[model samples]
Target: MINKKNILLAAVIFPAVMAFGQQYGGMWIPTELNEKEMKAMGMKISAKQIFDPAKPSIKDAVVQFDGGCTAEIISPKGLLLTNHHCGYDNIQSHSTVENDLLANGFWAKNMGEELPNPGVTVDFVLDIKDVTGQILGNTKNLDAKQAEQVIKNNIDVVSKSFKTEPHQKVIIRPMYYGNKYYAYIIETFKDIRMVGAPPSSIGKFGSDTDNWVFPRHTGDFMMFRIYADKNNKPAEYSKDNVPYKPKHFLPVSIKDKKEGDFTFVFGFPGRTTEYLPSIAVEKIRTEIDPAMIDVRDVALKTLDEKMRADQATKIKYASKYASVANYWKKWKGEVEGLTKSDAVGKKQHYEQSLIAKNPEVKTTLDEFNRLYTEQSPYALSRAYYSEVIRNAETLSLANNFYNFANAAESGKMDAKTLENFKNRLTEIYKNYDPELDAKVTAKVLALYANRVQPQFLPSGFEQYKDVNRNLQTIEELSKNSVITGRGTLNGATMYSGIDKVFEDQNSLVQNLKNDPLMKLFTSMRESYLTKTDGKYAEYQKQIDVLQKKYMAQQMETDKNRTFYPDANSTLRVTYGEVKGSNPKDALYYGYQTHLSGVMEKYVPGDYEFDVPKKLIDLYNKKDYGIYKNSTGDVPVNFTATNHTTGGNSGSPALDANGNLIGLNFDRQWEGTMSDINFDPRFSRNIMVDTKYILFIVDKYADAKWLLNEMKIVK
Candidate 1:
């Protein structure tokens, strides 16, 4: 039954084929790089130079920005560079009608003028250690549940017992679906300050229409600085804290780039599911992605109409609309890319080949098929519920109040907790427009009621079937609901009443229970918790166990093929050549975009494409200075083959010698499916060329003092 000879032959041939097909993709753990392959692909530096835990290296310059995106320290003074979108929330938090940073942009004339962000942080990975043997050694003979507990216990012991500085912490992450584990010793600096940002017209030039598309000219970089205590260690924000001096900083490169130059992205990349079974991929492509996209489609349409009608509404909903549109557009592209690349068919063929060679994996593959088939409905229901609650601000607020009420009932709501809740509510209402939110809630609820199956629909959601009635009901309910702060507690008085409501926990709980919005939230959440969440989680747990087994088996069976763990918000290195592609038939794209393209797309007074007057003046005057390429144009953005994903935003796209050449921001529209199925022919990570960043700073913004700090590599 086991064809050992065939398996041996298959491993040798299949690896070569797979390598060629995958082509310049793989988010490699810095500790374990394919050094030979990297060098062969034209890396001038050694792997040790890339990630030496004992000394300063490229890894020292990279940080996990604000816990989600990546940013690199570009100067010895901890001048951090990241994408505008990555720093969007922090930027918006400081903006107002009088000082709209998002619209006009902000640049500090001196360090004293730098704006401090209270809670933002940058985490540096001090060291990474492999503790897979320690984690798995004791679990071999245990039951699944017992093994999980043992793993959790081991993780706690490993993390807590690990030697670290007072401010440093250790976090262990499972890789290859728990086949391995790595503990990261991280130093988190909390005193991050915004130094500069370009206006939205430059930072988010093409907006939604050009978000994931290539041949883009968006100058999407933002600047921030890290501050630390006297000893240059992590500390809480204080005015006296000095600028952090980093161990290493990337030298910004303004050198011209060629099509075949070697490039590598070094930073934290978010989640990716490269190893999912064919059935799972298919479900995501067809059922799950489509369902989520449809819900957001409705929400975006409603937000867009209201935003265009009023400037204040636009300012209020800018971040919310962008966040929703991002994944919505990405999912649409993912589906198209999946279909265009024949991802499911390719995965099926690969599975067939694997099973044919190693027959033992057939059982695992069969199990995957069965589990996925059974899990489809639960997955779709979960997706719909998540989208509905996420888009509808009123429902989200209601859910928050319900949780607060429950916490109060459980005696968990202390004075500090109540204060925090009040602050959070204030922040929420700061940008909230009830009229806009009610419209969105009505639309998304109707979609949810219509699309979800009867059995999966939440009880009382039948009332949402009529959109007009739902809108009217929501409007009327909002007038008196404490959660909405309308009617009796209108405007400033409403905010003051927040404290009064909390004074009597019993009355507050009763009021929350009776609130119509809370009732709706309770219905939806309870249905999910009762009917869908548990079953979906259980199925996922089983699938995960099987997947771990599947991973080990595949590795054992195909010894020649190299495997990289999927991205899980960990520091990684992905290398490739600077190149472009014909993502579709009869349409070829170049590797780079120029500033000229920005002007070409510019429309006067347009929201998305309008160019700043200073930038236009510089372009007309041909004042490119040192940032201009040999071809007499400033490089705006470029594309490369490095495999990246969501959290890779603001990652440093480095040259072969480890200089920061560009800021990794977005991906080509057809390549957004790289997270699930990376087709090298189409997958490209877009980056704002460092030259463009410099040009904008020196010429457009006149922030030469900031540039003076950076090590500019010619």
Candidate 2:
């Protein structure tokens, strides 16, 4: 049940908050507990009900074969379902034009057709225990610092006790900040393999352009299977490895369901920020988002220019370009939201109003704003330097860790791991675009040098220069690529290493503590007053006073309303009717699209949204097969406005009654801002019409057994 008032506050009040309406909860109903609501609309069972090991619907039928994304046991013999891009690296590693599994969808007519993916594994969540008692069981009145450490210690102790063996993995995550903690005991299977994936042409048709946007026509989905040893335990792959057994696969029904059908999504949704000071909001809008947009735009433009001039360069940069361009588009959207929306003014007003109500909160508001104002610019500069220009610094640090580890610790690297790391270096360095990397690195550092403080510098780099525009001189210093590139790539090892990182000798860290360049970067970041310990203290005080007031008034004004805490990556439920919205009277994003619209995106030469020949051939064959939706052809589109964020990809979108109706792959770009502003009009969940997926499987792949496995109903 939702609190009517809070829902109104989320859906209407607070313009910025309402704008990002769908980012609040998750993709689907997790348990059969949600089944009653699901059935009212002619659906089956909640994803939670289907996948929860404790639930009855598919409890025994579901298996948690670990993958980056979740997978479900869908067959009497273990079969798994997951997204294709999650398996991209593995599939790409084994593919060539002749047998490009990505370009042409892989179909295993039988278990023998499945291919092995080394180092890939599936994890099954075996047990989850709510340990709120164990954590807050004592010391309810401890100071924040003491509480933090105590929580850590308590979690460690409980985690150790819960572990059945060394092979199982243990995780204890706190929920609602300090309110609760959950321990998840997992059994990880290391030897998982790729069953099949459609070519990017079809599987990822819209590519970046259609990535977060809609009228979005993209297949953006895929499938895989997990394997195990005959003992039904996790195992490494070998010629002898065989198909995993016993689990439930989703059943399909082509029965026509009309618009406004109830829908939901269930998958491991990663993270969100429904709780933040409007102060943070203003800062993000004013300084952070814009600066990032500009920096990424510059790099992407440079890369695109070079890639366009040379075919070989383009191929080499396909992945890089795709990544850069995709995010650049996102940032640009963010920038637009910042400028066009009332994020800044609204945040300011909200903070001010909060402070006005409680004199006790004035100090906290003042301190927060004081720090936020100071740090905003500096924080923005460091972000550009760290993320865009000095991007190599991260890899440098990683390499340094490896180096220090092997150098300081004896027997740190096994032969295979060492070989693997060496191979990684060889590959990275060989194709590494030194010129582009250096150019970006130099500019970023220049920004830091000019904008930040020298006091922050390490004594070494500091003695040579002051924090000023003179950082351009460092670019000249970079001319010795033999010097800069070598130092950044190889010399980083002197400071970084696996064993060394874990070791307590902060000697290298201290030595570089005064490194002028690093200090300069640090100084730039120090500008943000938001992180000041004193400021946070004051802010906490004010919040304490204000929360007491706000809570009382909120209770009186919105009586009998359900108000859950902001999403803490814990389980939660949100309910809404399925309806399309008119963002503006003149424009409306219909909650559905068809296969023919996908065909319309086809162009002969462009790679971005080009349709694959085989899929086109399959479509032209006029064979709807099992993939046809109510319209009698593959259904390619559906919609939902459930709140979602980064981690929600691949969640199963269930209709009312908890039946699997669609797979949530993306949010419409118009709604990409859904994270910050969910305009139900444009913010809708993008799903790969289940019927279309079934068509790809049955008509295209001919996996009749897969169809037989699930209890499909309409």
Candidate 3:
């Protein structure tokens, strides 16, 4: 609930033109774009051309890829383009030792050869509407809990009452800390199929070493196609389904790009916390990021060693390693970037000015500082629990068993629930290695025991303080635990006869309860549930309330300041220019990289820098075809000033004329902190030049059928 003081401060933040002097940055909603400013920055298309619900527009082509990343339609036949990593899981699912699609890429010669993905979906934004007033209309006097329920009820009613087709879903998301709300009418197509993907040597080139670094030569793009029913609407995957006909698809542009050429990213950018107070930012930089990084560092080291030694292990853990390493490295860079950029100092200075302008803001800032100080330890404990349980795969599996056992005891385990559990267990064991997990668990648990405060440590975890003894205990558990199914201990294993074991719920629950790994997981889970979680949630709610008020206060205090809601996984338009950066003193990065750079970094038989033989041959022969740029070298990757974050992966980077020129992938290491503190000096989004994608399909893979479908503009 909001008080009278805050209520008075709360006004409609969404004006037609919110920004004034700032030329770049901001993830603007499609409906409220700054047309004049975009034109001034070299945009040749009108706002209507970018997004028109009634007609074909650029927005019609872009979609939310499988809910986590972005993708766009590239042809009239619904050919989709996204990052290789975005499709990594599907590719990995189809790979085996005999035919490793990841090591040697996959290309479909014709439509009939395309591989269907069971659960993949591409969502289109049919329309967006402001639903703030209706959502918050009756909750001014209620407390936080009561108001939350009322808001939820309102959202349910509003969504159900909205006029939409049966295929469309209405999602309402709050912005500016619940100050505003927007409803998105989404049409999700579930029948998506993989068309082509380059090998890891091309798609994931430079892997960990160059993940967030500039001068990156990674191709990082994958191709898929959407399918629809006879009516050309969303449907389940069926043999009768046909390639979808899209209303709009991007025109592939091979025109030469110059520095400062207007570029904009259109995608569903993920979460960002750009409005946190100085105290919060300082805590994250100093305490939170380092703690999580430490946990992942141990897990990645153990996994990387095993992966390099065995090909089977490599295939199993490739996706897992990439997932862990992506954020582990990003956090390292985020800490550095926050420190280098002096984000806390700048935020503190701004806070002082804000308080000076309007003294009433002092209360809100003081509350923030106090809450953060009180909440730091609890927050750290929560982070440790989450990271430790996640990285220790055996313990994670045990936790799942614990949950299932509890459900069985509680009479909630129906046949479908049991079946789902079995399926999940099978999927996990498909990639599970008990010995490898044991090694990782020993190191991570030891770190957790030593680092977490005694008060926050789970009861059984205290024994883990003895590192050698802890290692021995985990070794024994991995060998005999029912969760791992490695060694027989009363004939209870996860592999076979799961249904027979579950026939007697009491016996199953008792067995799981007695398992050593499950006992360890229960101790940790119970301790957190009893000691830390409640307090953490309490402090977070208080912080969220104050933060919302603080946001309004800042807007009211600085009337001239432009405001945009922080990203919450919604379609946004972030425009900038093709530009380079000087991240540090005397350190400059160019806007683009070429095939020559890839060759220079190539190392034969190396995991990260290996180049495919066909690619090398093409490079030696200079066979770049029409995809070669004006410099007579094919561009591999490039950097731009468009503000982006995690979910922007696979977003479309459009040129001035709204042509697809690049596929947004990674961000420069120095810019990973842009989610919290965006400093234009160091923040740049990395992209794959569209020309490189075409070159790989045409010259390297010889998939001319794909190029024939695209509308390539020379």
Candidate 4:
């Protein structure tokens, strides 16, 4: 029942150069590389030489912030640099109308004035050592899954034993998911403080309208500082916070990032699932996303209308809008790109060719197609069933009640778990907006009524079918309050929150055992299990086969080349030139951007694109000052084709000599789908120029001591 058209499309989608036989194909050299090996492979230097901590190439350019985001140490006495947006939510949470830091911005003129945000920690990459020989001690007889687990268990065991390493912490991650694993021993800092930040007008200029788009002009940068214990070791904050001295600090410079400069980014990148099946991509592009977009579009429009009409509503949804609109736009673009591009077709062709060459892989693809075919009708319905999440007000209410029940069963979770729970809930509680939640939830349910299959919707919801949820929602929603019956939900005083609803003998938790909501959730859960579970299994199996095949091919072709497994994110390093692109010949995107571009993106009232008057005035006057590039306006924008993914946010973009030059934050919109298809034309990494970050810190923040600490190259 699988669509032949879909399969036909994937078989011939990619160029041979992109799909086959080259580890260093796109700017990444092997990690196992030595000085001689690298030089022979046309690399400028050995991988070890560049990555070595003691080498002049390595600098203390990074500053470990308490925990919110990564920062570079540009000064020996402990100054920190990172993105303002990375720390935006934190500042916004602590800010009040009387002292609205987000609206006006914050600047710590001196250490005494610096503010501390609790539960935040910064990590410094102290050293990286290869433990591959130790991990793969003997994976010869083990199958893929077993081999991966064996390597992982070994790394965890190794990392745990490394606790004795002075001033260090260890993280064991399996790169390429399981093909490779590494134990990273890092130094951590607990004392970090706010230093300087440009006002929203400047830092967040052209907020959303220009996000992920070229010709952008947002400053998008911030600064912080690190404090150490009296012994010069990392320690938690106290009244005795003192500057920690470093073995080396990165010299702050963007003096030489020419268009052809080889740039690399380093940091704890989040994650990327690059090896998704072509069929899966098609499903997202063609089936699921469009429906979800339609549903959200109605809700967003309704919320936009209300927010525009009321100030409280506007404030309530500002974060919500900002949070999702970026992705929504990206998804819209992705669906469009997927439909128009030859990616799916190419993938199918590639898959078919592989099948023709090796029959075993065909079973995996066949099973994958069969699963997707059987699941399509209900796949979306099951997913959209959670349309109830407009506001997780009930979840909190439920969580609180659950906590009470839990307390009765096992005294408050042990201190450690409790702290973890609190930390996890920090953003949830702070960002929850009730009115907006209600609106988002209600509109989604309304979407179910209008767009979902009749059988998929509960009868209670079916009555309002065939109506635009946004426009004709008031009549049906006027009576559909979040809680249907107080007696059923709030049974006891102890059931103070939704959590306790699970505790009471008369609990909604029990009601949910037979409740429609729970039924929907159950049905959806079953569908997913019966749906993607099989596809995922097949996908993983194919990955195993392909990894083995690729490794086999490598074994035959060049045994001397240090082969690294693809970026399983256990660790990855991508190297590339800083070059501009022609998304298509005439419509080119330059590699670098300027402060004026930020001003250009400033629309008067767009939610994500508004520029404050102060920033606009500065730009109009061509007042970038010393921060301007040699061509004149202080270089506000720069680009790199380093193959980056989501987890790379706050990654330090380094130059050929390994000097800190930019903080990789996001990718352009045209390249949001780069995880699937890494088109060189659009997949450029967007970074806040190191110089621009310094300008904001030194000039805007006026944090003089912090400025003096950094060794800025003019």
Model 1: worst 10 consecutive residues (lDDT sum): 487-496
lDDT by residue (1-714, candidate 2, tens digit) is 223686686455344333322323333323323344335434544456555655445433333333335445555556666666666777788788798767666766666777777777766555567787997687577776687688889988888887376457888876543465677777777667676666677678778667776676666566666667787676777767666665444554455557656665545555544335567666666666666666666566656677788887777777777776676677666555544545556556645665566554556556556666665544554455455432443224333443535454565556566557555655555455655554554544444444444433334444333423333544454443222233332234322333332234344444334444344444433432333334445555555444434444433343323233344443334443455545444766666677888888888757777776667788788777655665666677666666665545555665565555666677655555545543444556677767776777766667776666656664
How many clashes in each candidate?
Answer: 0, 60, 0, 54
Indicate the TM-score of model 4. 0.78
Return the TM-score for each candidate structure: 0.92, 0.77, 0.92, 0.78
Steric clash pairs (candidate 3) = none
How many angstroms is residue 54 displaced in model 3 relative to the true structure, after the best TM-score fit?
Answer: 2.5
Q: Model 1: clashing residue pairs? A: none
Q: What does candidate 3's lDDT look like per residue over 491-575, in tens digits? A: 5566666556566778767877788888888888999988899999999999998888898888789876667789999999998
Alpha carbon lDDT of residue 80, candidate 4? 68
In candidate 4, stretches whose alpha carbon ends up further than 4 angstroms from where it belongs are: 1-46, 53-69, 129-156, 161-163, 256-258, 339-341, 349-382, 386-443, 449-464, 468-571, 584-586, 601-621
Q: What clash count does candidate 2 reach?
A: 60
Better of 1 and 3 by lDDT: 3
Model 3: lDDT equals: 0.89
> Candidate 3 at 468: error in angstroms?
3.0
| Model 2: lowest-lDDT 10 consecutive positions | 481-490
As a whole number from 0 to 100, the lDDT of residue 504 in candidate 4 is 47
